[model samples]
Target: MVALNMTVDSQTGERAVRFNIDALVIAGWAGRNREAMEHHIAELEALGIARPKATPTFYRVSPSRLNSDPVVQATGENSSGEAELVLIAADGDLFVALGSDHTDRKVEAYGVTVSKQMCDKPVADRVWPFSEVADHWDSLILRSYVIEDGERVLYQEGSVDGLLDPRDLIKRYTGTDTLADGTAMFCGTLPAIGGVRSFTTFEAEVEDPKLSRTISFRYDIAILEDVG
Candidate 1:
């Protein structure tokens, strides 16, 4: 199990709670926009994957990579990053945070499952209790930035409304009313503003306008030489 020390703050004092992650589910092609979804599928196809079926796909990875560390190590330089909404089920309570589903694009072409296992996923330290944000969930915004060649650029920006509802995704994955405790799912992401690109550092945030608060995190990437 992956142990994560996450912080929660409010009228009460801030506390660092150790949570054990039992599963990591990465949801793919979950955009609500058909054109955008097609765009992503075409992106994957360009990398040599066959045409995708007309349904959302879920890839399960080892919980050990569901990390909060501010740095990630990659085996090569071909991987790109994207921001996504993350759902965490801990001790029978659900929480939401911002995260990056960093993937090895080259390896993904061969097998999405194996590619997902090649890199560690990074997530924000602070999270909101799902119940607190459930009423205003649609108003939440998800965004991401990438540091390319010493320049920081806005890689992605969109509303959570652009994706399917969390409950619906959970239902599709678990075939139940709620996710099992210790499960963390990285909900789908929006289309990149320009195109998918590799980065030296990745940053992302989840902004709740109604509550006037945001949860953000950044991580640097270390590309290891592929000697194979």
Candidate 2:
């Protein structure tokens, strides 16, 4: 089990909490806009990944993959990070944070679930209470950037309106509107601006326009030598 120390940002104020997460779920094909979701599926299909059998598919990986560190290592150079909104249940309350569903592209072509397990999942250190921003949730924005050749380029950007509502997604995945404590879910991602590919450093953020607040994190990817 991995314990994550996260900060909660609410109207009342901010507090720190540590949770020994028991479950980690990555939700896929969860775009509320069917056209946009299909577009992302096509992006992966072009890379030889298969289509998911159902909409908003839930993938369970090890809780140990949950990481809030500034650095992550992945074997080979075929993995990349996609911006996502993570729902974390803690202290009997649900909070939302920014996440990067860092995945391995090569293994994904043959084994989607296994690919999701092959790398560390990066998460921001802080989160907003679900109820605090529930009224303005749709206005939240998700954006990511990748540093290539010392130049930062926009990777993915979109409003949360493009994806399924957090409550709705939770209900579909768990048969209930509530997420249990110690569980964290990566809700979904937007289509890459250029395309899905590898990067040495990835930075992502979730912004609440109405509240003028944002949660962001950056992680450098170190590719280890493949010795076989």
All candidates: TM-score: 0.94, 0.98
- lDDT scores for all predictions? 0.84, 0.92
Candidate number with greatest TM-score: 2
The sequence of per-residue lDDT tens digits that candidate 1 reaches over residues 1-228 is: 898888874425567777788889999888777887788778778777656564678989998887878788898898877899889998888888778899998888888889888888898888888888888787899889988778888988878887878888999999997999888999999878777767889989888888788889999998899999
Note the residue pairs that clash in candidate 2: none
- Give one digit per residue, the lDDT tens place, for model 2 in 1-228: 789898888878999988779999999999999999999999999899999999988999999998888899999999999999999888788888888999999999999999999999999999888888889888999999999999999999989898999899989988987889889999899999978989999999989989888899999999997775
Cα shift from native, residue 139, model 1 (Å): 1.5
Which residue ranges in model 1 land beyond 4 Å of their true spot?
Answer: 10-13
